[model samples]
Target: MIVIVDYGAGNLTSVQRAVSYLGYESLITNEPEKIVNAERIIFPGVGAAGSAMEEMKARGIDDALEKAFKSGIPMLGICVGCQIIMDGSEENDAVCLGLIKGTARAFPSGMKEENGILLKVPHMGWNGLNVVQPHPLFNGVGKEDEFYFVHSYFPEPLDRNNVFGVTEYGVEFVSAVGLKNLFATQFHLEKSGKPGLLILKNFCIWEP
Candidate 1:
C-alpha cells in the first residue's frame, strides 16, 4: 500500500485524491509504523517547515521516514515535503530529513522579469521545467508541459548531479531532485493537471 504521510502540514487529502485518481490505493496518516511499512510513500505538504518538522518529531514520523528511505522504498515528495528532505531549510532555520545533501533557501528579494516588472515572492502559478538530467519520473513529460508552483523557497542540492529539473521565476532554481530511491519536486504535481498526473503515474510504477 502507498502511504501519504501526514505530519499536520496539510495537503494530504489532495495528494491522496490524486493518487487514487491514478488507480492506486493510498492512506494519509501520521502513523510512523504505517509509513515505514508502506510499499511506496508520498510526502506532500503545504505549510511552514519548522512546525511541520516539530509535528513529525513529536509523532516520531521523522525516524519512520528515514527508516523507510534506507529500506529502498520508492518515495516522492512535493512542495514543503520536497524542501524538508534536504539538510536544512531557511524557513525557521529548521534542520531537515537530510535525505539529500542540500538546503532550502529563500528566494532573493528584488526579483524582476526581463521587462523590468518586479516578480513576487511565493512564485505562484504555472511554469515550465527544464529537465537537466534524464529520470523516469519525467517519462513522456514534454518541454511544453508546465507545472503548478507555490513557494517562496527553493531547494539547492549540494550535489549538482542530484538535480533533475530547473525552472525560472526571476532566477533559475532547482525545481526537481532525486537521489537513489527518493525523488521530489518543488511544484505541486497534484495541482499541475495532466502533466502532473503523468508524473504521479510514473512514480506509482517507478522501480527506483
Candidate 2:
C-alpha cells in the first residue's frame, strides 16, 4: 500500500485518485504508524513552506518520517514536499528535513526580463522535463517528456549530479531529483496526464 501524507495539503485528493486509477491501493492519512508501515510513502504538499514544516513537527510526523525514511523505504516527495526532503527552503524561513543536502529558493527575478520570455510566477502549467539519469521514477519517459507543474520556486542542490531530471522556465533547472531511496520532483506527476501516470506507476511498482 502507498501512503500519501495528508497534513491539509490541497492536492491530496487528486493524487490519491490518480493512484487508485492505476490499480494500486493507497491511503491518505497523518497517522504515523500507518505511514511508517506502508509499502511506500508519497509526500505531497502545497502552500507555505514554513507552515507545512510546522504542521509536520506539531504532529510529530517530522520524527516519524525521519525514522521511516532511514529504514530504507521507497519515498517520494512532490513540489514543496520535494523541498522538505532537502535541507530547507529560502521560502518562508523553513528548516527542512535535510535528508538531501540542498536548499530550495526562488527563481531569479530578472532572468525572465533579460531572457525575452514573459514568464509567469508560480509556473502553473505543463512543462517539459530533461532526464539526467535513466531511473525508474522517469521510466517509460524521455528527455522531451512534459509533466504538470505549479510552482515558482525550484530546488538548487549543491551536488548537481543528484538531479535526475530537469525542467525549463526562463532557464533550465532541476525538475526532479533522485538520491538513493529518496525521490522528489518539483513538478506534480499526479497532474501531468499520461506521462505523469507513467512516472507514478513506476514509483508504485518500485521495489523497496
Candidate 3:
C-alpha cells in the first residue's frame, strides 16, 4: 500500500484520488506505524514550511519519515513537502527535515525578464522541465513535457548531482531531485495532466 502522509499541510484527497485512479491503494494518515510500514510513501504538501514542520513534529511524523527513508522504502515528496526535505527554507526561516542537503530559496524581489516584463511572485502556471540527469521516474517523460507548478520558492540541492530536473520562471531552479530511495518534485503531479499522471505511474512501478 502507498501511504500518503497527512500532516495537515497537503492536498491529501487529491493525492489519494490520483493514486487510486492509477489502480493502487493508498492511505492518508499521520500515524507513524502506517507510514513506516507502507510499501511506498507519498509526502505531498502545500502551505508554509514552518507550520508543516510543526505539524510533523507535533505528531512525531518527522522521525517516522526519517525512519522510513532509512529503511529503504521508496518515497516521493511534492511541493512544500519537497521543500521541507531540504536542509532549510526561506519561507518562515524554517529548519526542515534535512532528508537532503539543500536549501529552499524564495524567488528574488524586483524580478524582471530580459524584455523588461515584470514577473509575478508566486509562479502559478504550467512550465516546461529540462531533464538534467536521466532517472527511472522520468523514463517515459519527455523533456518537452510540462508540469503544473505553484510556488515562490525552489530547492537548491547542495550537491548538484541530486538535481534531476530544472525549470525556469524568472530563473532556472531545481524542480526535481532524487537520491537513492527518495524522489521529489516542485510541481504538483496531482494537479498536472497527462504528463503528470505518467509520472505517478512511473513512481508506482519504480523499484527504488
Candidate 4:
C-alpha cells in the first residue's frame, strides 16, 4: 500500500481521493512503523515553512521522513513538502531535511515596481511548465499542460542539473526536481484533475 505522510499538513483527503481515482490503495499515516512498511510515500503540505517543520519535528515526523528517504522508498513531496527537502528556507529561518543541496527563497519583487514590490505574493493558480529533463514522476504529464500552484516561495538549486522542470512567475524557478529516488513538485497534482491522476499513477508504477 502507498502511504501519504500525515503530520497534519496539506489536502490529505484530496490527495487520498486522487490516489483512489487512479485505482491505488493508500493510507494517510504519521506512525513511523506504518510509513516504513508502505510501498510508496506521498508527502503533501500546505502551510508556512517554520510551523510545518515544527509540527513534523514535534511528532518525530522529521526523523521518520529521514529514515523513509534513506530507505530509498519512492517518495513524492508537494509544495511545502517539496520545500523541506532542501537545506533551508528563507521564510522560516529554520533548517530542513537537507536531502538535496538547495535553498528555497521568497519570490523576487517585480523590477517595474520602483519600491522593489513583489509581482504578487503567494503566487496562486495555474501556470505552464517546461520539462527541463525527463523524469519518472512526470511520465504522463506534458510541457504544454498547466498545473495548479499556490506557493509564495520557490526553490533555487545551486546545481542546475538538479532541476527537472522549470516554471516562470515574475522569475523562473525549479518546479520539478529529482534527487536520486526522491521526487517533488511545486504544483498540486491532486487539484489538476485527470492529468494529475496520470502523474500519480505513473509514480506508483515507476520502479524507482
TM-score of each: 0.99, 0.95, 0.98, 0.93
Q: Which is better, 2 or 4, measured by TM-score?
A: 2
> Could you say which candidate leads in lDDT?
1
Q: By lDDT, is 1 or 3 better?
A: 1
C-alpha RMSD (angstroms) for model 1: 0.6
Candidate 3: tens digits of C-alpha lDDT, residues 83-160 = 999999999999999999989999998788889999998999999999989988898898678999999999999999
Of the candidates shown, which would achieve the greatest TM-score relative to the real structure? 1
Off by over 4 Å in 2: 113-117
User: What local lDDT does model 4 show for residue 55?
Assistant: 82
For candidate 4, give the lDDT.
0.83
Lowest lDDT block of 10, candidate 3: 136-145
Query: Residue by residue across 48-67, what tens digits does model 1's lDDT show?
Result: 89998999999999999999
- For 134-154, candidate 4 gives per-residue lDDT tens digits of 887787786678889999887
Local distance difference test, each candidate: 0.95, 0.84, 0.93, 0.83
Task: Quote the positional error of residue 41 for candidate 3 in Å.
Answer: 0.2
What's every prediction's RMSD, in angstroms?
Answer: 0.6, 1.5, 0.8, 2.4
Off by over 4 Å in 3: none
Candidate 2 overall lDDT versus native: 0.84
For residue 63, give model 4's deviation from the true position in Å: 1.2
